[model samples]
Target: GLSSCFHRSEGFMRGYPRVRGFYEVLSSCFHRSESPEGLEVYLHALQLLTTIHHGIQTLAVAGGTGQALWTFLCEVVCEDLCQPDDPPFVLQEQKGLLVHALAVLSVLYACQNQEAEHSEADTLLPLVGSMLRVLQYHREVSSGHGQKEKKEEEEEEKVDEQLQALIQTTVEFLSDIITHLTKDAVCELVTRGYLTEKTCLSAVGSLLPQFSPAVQHLVFMLSEADPQLADTVRKEFPVSLSPS
Candidate 1:
């Protein structure tokens, strides 16, 4: 439904009076502790809005709906889906919603970069924790599937598409965050209890090679600040811990 608007005209969503408070209406019904039956449909529609320039501009307008949307999404990701306490296999259960939520957040975050606006720790760090949790769990589930034969893997492709989307979404967003990481950002992750020694090992498992440099830089910053935590990470990932 929303995709139809994208091809039709610019500002269609913004100009549509009936669409006002659309997010609030949907969000109010989906509580943080619950995922009602059709939540993914709504989240997917919201995600469609991030696909076009005017749509991205509309949602990323900081100090307005962008800020509100960010807050609501952070809660959904950090609180509602793929929680640290959830098992990695849970990724299969939540992939559809996770992909949509992450896609929207990633676009909005990129928009903030153009404006040179920094996302608050509340909005960003917890989401980082959740995103890392997503990857770690995805890795766990993927490895769990390592025993699948070629035929089985091929047979599962239809079922695996949404899971693949979730992985791609989480990785892209994490890559963006890593690309723009800073000392203060690392500190916030630590201070907020988002990044710990166990998380350091697990989160880096799937992102090897491609994400090595940025992840190493992150650990190096950790060393400069929280040496003990850095030491734990270095011990766990000696290969990825090379000086960057």
Candidate 2:
């Protein structure tokens, strides 16, 4: 059981003072190891992090305890999880860790946005970049997989769906961030290659209905970045000089 496992693991139980630690000695072994052994420590930490994230998400859904999880997520993002160096692992393990971390952070931000009265765009922007980097890496791996199984239509569809979801979430987050940034920042976002034509179209289609004229103009500028996309937009959204 999870309770038993938690009780047996000191590092996992450290955050829970009420519980007696059973694995304290084994946990000390982690701290005693050298920097290279930190990878093993991180593997354990990731396990605990996964449990905490899921437990908090569940509590949030039940209206029990979400803030604790949110705080933990912030700490993990700032301190532990976003390491500069990738671990030396098999491809599968590396991919699994990346996907798990990205999924947890994505849910955390989405929940925070939904629960808060105002937007937390600043806090979320960097997260969007991080998630994009992970997704881009995943997409590259997936493209290779797709080529390897080019004739397998079902497998290709599964890969496409995963890629599409990543793209959609990225566009949504970027759109939200753009809404809070200056026009210059928004322009820089496009010029820096962070906002592509597909993302721009997605952002416009999703944000235009709710944003102000200024935001609409920014979206217009983004859409106009690509003439082909601009022409498509004009055709799809024909303007009328006269009032309806």
Candidate 3:
């Protein structure tokens, strides 16, 4: 079925106007859907696009044909999917969709193409806060802080387990984006105070132990980009994270 869809949609690869039209159609499906099945189809469509060269270049990249989808993914899709209250099954499904979206955007930003006029920091700084919030929620819920009832604790534990992969995916996504940022962009992020030591500790320090070494290395690379912030991150996390 996916193969069939890809074959049929090849015309979308031609240029910006076609890409924008394609984006509008699928985004409409995503916006109109209230059911999980409905949401999944549109997400699947977006995922399918990532597999194609044009799908990514035309739709995912900044200043590409798919600015609408890019903005929607950043402003709404990610925010909604990061919520802790969704049903477990729904959350699991949303996790896959969000990861796909993140992959698209991360690749776009990392490429550093001249087509996009905006600085990577301009697009990425706001997302760091969203990413941190999701990570903090996962860390707090998984560790179990103030559960008075056994049932509630058990429920939280179950949600915590389901969320494990989601947390890892989110971390990997942010790590890739952070590691790819230009030196000047990272400096701007730090100088503006959008990325503080407290935020870094909350994201990197608290979650470092739980991450696989590869993901940890990626986060470590982010620290390496900024000496002062790196010192703060290293102090807070304090784990051996040598690059391979």
* Per-candidate alpha-carbon RMSD to the true structure: 3.9, 9.7, 6.3
1-244: candidate 3 lDDT, tens digit per residue: 7657575665744532455665676567666647546555555566666677776666544566555555666665445765434432444345556655665555555543523532444456666655655565545544564223455777767755646756766777666555555555556656765456655666775455555463355445555666666766666666555663
Candidate 3 regions off by >4 Å? 1-19, 29-37, 60-62, 77-97, 111-122, 145-165, 182-198, 205-232, 239-244
**lDDT: the better of candidates 1 and 2:** 1
lDDT of 1: 0.72
Q: In candidate 1, which residue ranges exceed 4 Å CA deviation?
A: 1-5, 11-20, 32-35, 113-118, 145-155, 231-244
Candidate 3 lDDT trough over 10 residues, lowest sum: 83-92
| Model 2, TM vs. native | 0.38
Report lDDT (Cα) of residue 50, candidate 1. 76
- CA lDDT for candidate 3: 0.57
lDDT of 2 by residue, 81-181 (tens): 33324322222333333333344444544555443612343444345434434444444454463133244788657755655554455445544544455
Tens digits of per-residue lDDT, candidate 1, 36-149, equal 556777777778777767667777666667666777888888887767777666676677778888898888788865334445676777888888787767666666742333
Q: What is the C-alpha lDDT of each candidate?
A: 0.72, 0.43, 0.57
What's the TM-score of every candidate structure?
0.80, 0.38, 0.60
Largest lDDT belongs to which candidate?
1
Candidate 1: residue 216 lDDT (0-100): 82
Which is superior by TM-score, 2 or 3? 3
